[model samples]
Target chain A: MTTLSLGAARAGVELRSFWRERDAVVFTFALPAVLLTLLGSLFSGVYEGSTVTSAQYLVPSMIAAGVASTTFVNLGIGIATDRDNGTLKRLRGLPMPPLAYLMGKVLLVLAVTFAEVLLLLAIGMVLFDLPLPASAARWLTLGWVFALGVVACSLMGVAASALPRSARSAAAVLNLPYVVLGFISGIYYTPIGALPDWVIQLGSVFPLKWMAQGFRSAFLPDTVLPQEVVPSWEHGRTALVLAAWCIGGLVLCLMTFGRRSRQTS
Target chain B: MTDHAVRVRGLRKSYRDTVAVDGLDLDIAVGEVRALLGPNGAGKTTTVEILEGHRSRDGGSVSVLGVDPARGGSSWRREIGIVLQATDDAGELTVAEMIRHVARYFPRPRGLDETLSLVGLESKRDSRIRRLSGGQRRRLDVALGIVGRPRLLFLDEPTTGFDPEARRQFWSTVRALDTTVLLTTHYLDEAEALADQVTVIAGGRVVAEGAPDTLGSRDVATVSWRDGREQTDDPAAVVARLTAAYGGPVPGLSVTRPSLEDVYLDLIGVPR
Candidate 1:
């Protein structure tokens, strides 16, 4: 119980530190909003024959993509820097439980991801004239997707931190997944139908695809999109798959991060 | 009367193919400031880390405050404090905020104002941690270690980069704490100034352990005058003889015992 409280306090401190940097806030939230606006306005080709606007289709995916990038790249780089500076080793020597330290990091990821999602959604609604979901059920689905995306991406960030020996290398490793997934998950473009079958299958195994799909369900009406072999917005299956990825990611993160800490110490 | 704050029997540790701590034994009583002096890679840091429960030993029986640190839980950790060599500088929080945040983890902790005053940073309580000077930052590290009012504290080369004035101020702070302090340093003067007992480790083994005044147990003393000098086991008798010859106190005469550094250098077999 004390561990949990300590973790929450430390997480608050971490969040405050991150929010103090004006450039980081801009990079985390504003860039995604700006990109969503630019791409939504210029890319009407996305829904030429459909009834949905480009903003309606692209904003949700961008929101998902923004969450993923913040969790993986931002967190991965931050932890690596802490390691390089001996901050992690110092914390290990304290009386606090190991879980407290990890919980703090996880909470930091959650706070940042939430801020990013809200900012993107606000921009989409106010500036791009995108409509909110019509019912509480649809909004609930969106919430589940956002929550699962945070867990999966934060765990992936912890896993990626182990791949690089230094902070710079960790940033490089993190950027790879962020850039590739942004394209493969159709954040900047609508390629769900055009992507190769195997590529889509592999993407389905990850949370990004489900997150995008769930967001689309909330923002877009079913009548406008083309009929596919299987509908993208099956709420039950999307939640199940994203939940599974989150669990798998948690296991991988615990194993990899604990092992790395011991080895380095 | 003999309850040791720390007791170790045959401590040994290895890193893959290389051994770090090798069959080391030590016992330090409560309230004793024991200084572990050695060159780099002499296993000082490794041994300290193991004692702090941050590293595991291959073999050892280490009882710190009546419990083995290797298996000690959070309760045991509450009794000990460790000042690491470096800290995270990313946070924009002020020193006061940082201390308050860490204080929540301990069962009982010193007040924030007392801690700030103890570290001589009362004026900088509102200053951001990142804006502090190097000496001020190190003081913050010390402040954090003592804020919990730990029964035993480990300081690793605490004053390595400090200027003379800053180092003196740090020594005063350590003196004021009056807790059991186990420090490791390459500076002999620091040991002589602060340590009640000194232990020198060389090549992963204890070379000597005793008070700073009589470390080497060398009986010989040097008697010097304006003209010449002589070595003798009895410096007082020689001083009396010299005074008689000069028909008064011998001019510029002095009897000198070996300095702790000289004895230490001789024991470690390093050419001065």
Candidate 2:
């Protein structure tokens, strides 16, 4: 339908707006890389007899970290600011298709997430000589994880857009969850499975844990970690958990968006 | 001529315990510019929002271009243009890019260059929205609104914060548009200049509706001269008599009807 195309076009516009901002692009891409390097260097020798380079472990974690930073923190704050500045109100008045507006945001988040993934993967390959997945299937699994991670994180960002009363407060609140999730899910350290039993269990309940797990399956070989813990890259569970997160996040975002629209109306 | 751009009867909306628009009725014909003049919180913006299909009314029979705006589809939205009070300025997109991007939403949109020229921003098309002056940004808002070639345009205080020269330029732009325009503003001068018919709303109801010159309908005219002023029912007779008494054309003399602002302020009641 023409309406659908228009909607997609609008989403394209939103995506372009994000890409045009140098500071936002730098923060989204560079910050995660910088943090990965710092954490990798700091924890280079924490575990004995561990063949995994800190950068190797950190690369996979940064995929999850990238989503949290870009999709959740960056997007959540940007949307809240849009709402506060009457941008949303203005858009609502246009001849724009409703789906187009939302699709634009989704496209933007997806593009940024993809870019982050690629950048992190490049850093791993060149700087740390991280091994490529041995087979096409392994690479396919990695792509699914990254794609689903983006969806889950973007949904969380949309839901979080409703929490803050202003742009400044929204940025602060969005950052807290991202930092907490990054630390808990092992984006800057070893997998949560290596932590205490309760910590791993708690982390598993969140999307970050499964996201990191999925990324780890792609980058690390079967010989690297305990078989029982890594489980030889279970594609089924990775797809299911990440899909569930995407759906749950979308539902929450829709509910919050509807509520906010009604309240403001 | 048969199509009414906007038609509403008994429109009502409430916010919690407060009633914002109560039993308001309006009928705007095609190609007519109607100004809704009122004090702040007189339900002008609320009424406009309802007509724009952005808000729901508690009770009403309302039609915009023969469709209930509350349930109007995307096709209906394409026919309406809304110039909001503010818009997104944080994006680094150039003015031309922003206009062209938004223009794609409509089935038939004005040319980008033409729209920019109409709003007097042709030279600044390459400038980022954030880099624009306040007046230039306001012009950009107008450019976006008209870019879609909407059949009906809703302008909510479009000239607020504009300098006098820019305001005059804006007035010309409004005059040039053939579409029906429904404007809400506290500026009586703006209403007088741009509106073909004026409706004064006070306390959520239409207090007066007529041509700007005759709203109060007082036959009495005020005749002023260098010495003093007097109110008379017959200004022509008074002027004729004055000419005879002065032995020539009356010196420094003028006859004035009550301005729209005077009638509006009087109807709304001047602050104590």
Q: What is chain B's TM-score across the candidates, in the order shown?
A: 0.92, 0.90
CAPRI verdict (incorrect, acceptable, medium, high) for model 2: medium
* Cα lDDT tens digits for candidate 2, B175-203: 98889999988898998899988888777
Off by over 4 Å in 1: A22-24, A191-205, A227-241, B218-220, B224-230, B233-236, B243-257
Candidate 2 Cα misplacement greater than 4 A, ranges: A46-50, A191-201, A226-243, B1-3, B223-233, B242-256
The local lDDT score (0 to 100) that residue A220 gets in candidate 2 is 78
Tell me how many residue pairs clash in candidate 2. Answer: 2
Write candidate 1's Cα lDDT for B101-126 as tens digits: 77877889999999999999999999
TM-score of each predicted structure versus truth: 0.91, 0.90
- Tell me, by DockQ, which candidate is best: 1
